[model samples]
Target: MAGTSKPAVYKYSRGAQPGTAARTGDWRFLTPNWIYRPSPCRIACPLGSEIPAWLEAVKRERFDEAWRILRRSNPFPAISGAVCFHPCTENCNRGQLDESIAIPELERAVGEWRQKHYRPPAGPPVTRGRVAVIGSGPAGLSCAYYLNRAGIGVTVFERAPVCGGLLALGIPQYRLPRALLSRELEMLKDDGIIFETGVAAGGELPLDRLNEEYDLLFLAVGAQKERPLNIPGAEAAGVISAYEFLRRVNLGETVRLVEPVIVVGGGNAAVDAARVALLQEGITRVSLVYRRTRKEMPATADEVDAAEKEGVQLYFNLSPQALRLEEERPAEILFEQTETAEGKIKVLPAPPRSFACGTLIYALGQQPDWEALGRLSRELTLFAGGDLVSGPSTVPAAIQAGRLAAAGIMERLKRRPGTGEAQFLEGKPVVGFEELNLAALPSAHLTRRLSDPVAEAGRCIGCGTCSSCGLCALYCPDLAVQWRRERYDVNLDYCKGCGLCARECPARALVMKGGWEDAC
Candidate 1:
């Protein structure tokens, strides 16, 4: 062809062009970045609460609005803010850059505002379906909160004279104050959750009576049984179990263990037990013995550090061999040093080493007492202990048992004498916030805010659920997150239980099981 000018060229005004006098296009749009990105903290939450949105409100000093948004998912933000084991902190992208934001503290600050202005929601009508929660621990309380919010009457039966099972009994005062516990209880009571303190459920209350009366029953009994130290002189005096020690402290008992205390185990309880033992000035030497190395220590890093800080000496790669009771003097806590091979620590090897201490605290672990559940033993046998055993192997496992039991009951109801149209309808998430334009989101990366160790109240020693981020309410795109006077509720129908909320969740709350699998 003639005068084709080598197929000519055209250049555009925006991006890379034809190299001639042509127009370029959207160079900025070509930059590949989400216009609106969700905060990692919000995305990691279980409730799927609008993290960035609420934070944006807070950044603008909209205290009222911030609380309003927060309360939509977590009714107990103030309590949870102060106590939730903030899992979101671990997942905060900012942590890689610097310290994550003091999310729990921020939550507490917002919760403080909410506490001042927040009003519990009043219900329209009460349903005949009554839910009886066995123990007044977090799981029980949480279940009660949601059940009550769903308009079901709830009754919490606790064997202890007081409420807040772990919150009241297991946790140290420095961490969870009694007043906060009472206030949270008051909040629940205001929402119509009944508490039968000092009433034993499996014994005096009886599940049969509950089943006969209520539409359904939920058992949230936590494992309180401390692992037994079956060794020579095991029945001797001055030996305290973790459960006993925590219970005594929680119930305000004055126990004085002699100096040279040897606590066994590397878990949080072991640390807590050792530290608490130090409160007894007579207890001078507090050493922890674990068969594992420092890396394998199951206790939270903070707890292990705190134990060391508080003068609780730890001897890793060691296990208690036996307890030698001198009848009156300091008991001997015999231990054997351990070794590792092929990445696994070798315990009870041929000829082991041993150490001696005064008072021996077997913090090996705890188990759940399944004797109470014996009535249903033949029928609905739920293992609190691992492997369908009658008892739970640990306190946390017991709590898990309670939750499983409750979930099972809920699932049974869903299958049997089923949910109404409104019941299933209510399970759907509520829509609130508008869709975010990911393309317009912040150009800056996740802003990590280092958490101040100084909790206005105290430090959280790994207990309970609900990570401080309250992410469950934040990341929920459907806005299904809501809170009633009693507690938090996530509408499952609308939730799809995508578990994006779960996987991203810092604290393993807002659990999702058996879902579409690709929603995340």
Candidate 2:
């Protein structure tokens, strides 16, 4: 009878009773199996800032704690919150549902809130160490902040007429307010970070001397030199470098330009300069000329859109070939129309010409003068992109580089030695983000906050780099998300290589490994 007993055949209809979509194994404890330890968003950030912790503080209105958490990665949250271009938002799990969370706004809120309410305790009088920083840009100011916090005195020297080398002069005020800049500088001063404005740290001021005086020296002199407009007779009276132009305008230069201005190049500088020129000339016909199409233009989309909306004309597929001079005065601007060839835009010979009344502002771009930097280029270090020659150029990138530089300096001092291990970077697999149980995370239906479409112009200038669609946080009925935060701090911890978070993020912001596709 046992042998004859019919082997039961359970039919699995498309919906035949599914086994309780079994609780994904708990790996956080790492008992029977390994648990993923990383917070997805933090993993996405370049600096690995404890995002979840600070964001949790922001959510709970613990502004001071949040500010402190942000300070751990970026000491200049106020500066970054304003202009750093929120890459975190691009990776936000909420972006899939609607728009991404207004991370910059949240950051700005916490930053401003902290600025108003909290204050760092002042350290005792300057002790043994002094860090001489060449510039007061984000890199320099940030380095000074960290060193000063560590009880090491920092003296920042700035060649610029003002304190912020790029932050004060290059960035437009509408984006990053001067008031906010001044406030952050004040905070640094209170924290024992000294700034010597108008002092050049180059040969005149002596870089060698700084190396001799301070225990450490950080060169952050930003790329100040501008690329000359290389058109015929570009040195004609009307041509000007975009850097000096923007700097002057931001510094309250009541600059009055001749009517019908033509701005060469389609970068941030070009857009800002053209828009400002329009504001000064009052709709006197400003044109942004770029050889490449708008897609390839280096200006942030917001910048380009704002310029267009503000009535700046755009001339794509055009490059100025020659600037006609007559009687020692410019007569006309000749441009060669461009056409895409072999996946690259190239200017054609003998092309269309446009007549203009006056000035040409070239924003083609700028770079660090290697000759000017000389051996310091070896020290300050810059790439063709004007970022530090090494590491990522973004805010988080600078954070990562600064941290590594600190480690290198520490090693040189024989404080902590490197392991001599080769850091060969190879991508590996991790958790299932979106595959989690959705019932746990309190109303997964609720969406993340975002910039209002109507108010997009005045606010919402984003760097556009997110993908976060939250499933892992919502699933794991055992409250795994909270546990992850508690154990490894979901802030910026590395994962236990589980696929849960990867499965849960609908945005596919995370990926996993070991041949476990979505099967896990």
Candidate 3:
């Protein structure tokens, strides 16, 4: 009986073989492919900055690399970091988790690192193409920088005694430190970019002469002409536009301010005017009057909050009716109660209220003076950008416009057939928060300003970017994903198309494509 049982016994076993032994991927209908899509923040950014790549570098404390990446898109990170409204943060996917990344602060940090470490190269003179960039604002500076970098001779013309059109003349010292601006300009100068101050393009130098001399011309004169307030006694002696007021103050002119100053409009200019007026000597009260409600105000929330904290009185739903003049100077301003309905302002039937105003500053925005350019403005070779073309846009937008103009100039210079159109995020698919595997990412609370930027940068989830976290390889049922040559590769021989790896990708970098027909 024992001999019979031993003879009948047979061994049977099954074990996992190497992925190379089987072509299991042939059985798959769908295939996982690594695809890069624009992140929501990148799409929202006017400059289209590669936020994830730079943030990754910043996470590793590679400040130089981060700065390099940042400068590729935006030349004035420091200036923009300070003044930018940061629309990028509004669309940040991380905001859905806890808080949006402090992109502005990080950008500023990178800019500061650049200021400390970057040294202009003493290379040979750029003798290739001659370009004259009119105005020294963000757009003009950005165009000049890119053109000069491309080995083109660039000369920037500024009407003001000092460079930086709006940046130097409009923005207050409290918001943007003069030292930082000076350092940036000095760096550009050292890089062989020429700057001619006290030279107006249309006036002294003449735009016709520049068009004849330079190979190409880029005009970024900016919107400096203030929109006049259409009200009774608006031309009173004490009444002035916010642009002119800020310009006078920024230029260090000795202007005496009356006791109580009234600022009209609800934009950043109005807030800046109110805040700046509060800093003046003998100025006790500064009131901001807006025709719309707080929510309808165009100023950034941060700026509004700062204005409130600085003792600036905010009066909403009040429209300026008329100014009472005493001896040809504004003495009291009459405002009528108003409300917005269907995007239109309607004055209430209530009697107009009067506020004592020693000085009335109108912050009704500015417009470009195209007349200043004359016939040169309509020239084919004259490319205009910044506030001149886009009205009063953000600094980052102006920078992007400058970059685009530079590309166009370069294209025309080379006699390229196609128009140098920038590849925008308009048609590209943007990654959403739902596409990410949140379980794989580490949770972090919002830390706006940490002593170490690396810690803050680590909070970035790197949406739409392959972070090489190895989660795809770790979660794969079959050992098809291989690490080779510093990157992840799918073996395909053993992939079953289960989509586990793609589902586990926290960065949403992997996507499943097609069915059996596609694989075949």
lDDT of 1 by residue, 1-520 (tens): 7885687575656665444332221111111111123345554454444544455455546777666666445555566666665665665543443455566677777766765665667754455567677678766776666566555677888889999877787767765667766877887887788889988865687657765766655665666777788766666787878768878877988876776787877777787788878876566678877878887877778778887998888887776677777855445766666776767877755565555656777776765666766654233322221212434233323333443444455554553322221111123332212221212223124333334322311211111123234454567565545454323455433553444444444423334434233222
Between candidates 1 and 2, name the one with more favorable lDDT. Answer: 2
Per-residue alpha-carbon lDDT of candidate 2 for residues 12-101, written as tens digits (9 for 90 to 100): 656755443444432333311123233444556666665555665555456777777777776666777788656666775445434555
**Candidate 3 off by > 4 Å:** 1-31, 375-380, 415-423, 443-449, 468-470, 473-498, 514-520
lDDT of 2: 0.62
Q: How close is candidate 3 to the true structure, as a TM-score?
A: 0.88
Better of 1 and 3 by lDDT: 3
For candidate 2, the per-residue lDDT at 177 reads: 94
Off by over 4 Å in 1: 1-54, 62-75, 122-127, 328-330, 348-356, 376-520
Query: Which window of 10 residues has the lowest lDDT sum in candidate 3?
Result: 415-424
TM-score of 2: 0.75
Cα lDDT of candidate 3 equals: 0.84
lDDT at position 56, candidate 3: 77
| Candidates in descending lDDT order | 3, 2, 1
Candidate 1 clash figure, as a count: 50
Candidate 2 Cα errors over 4 Å, as ranges: 1-46, 281-283, 326-331, 375-396, 414-441, 448-520
Give the winner by lDDT: 2 or 3: 3
What does the lDDT come to for candidate 1? 0.58
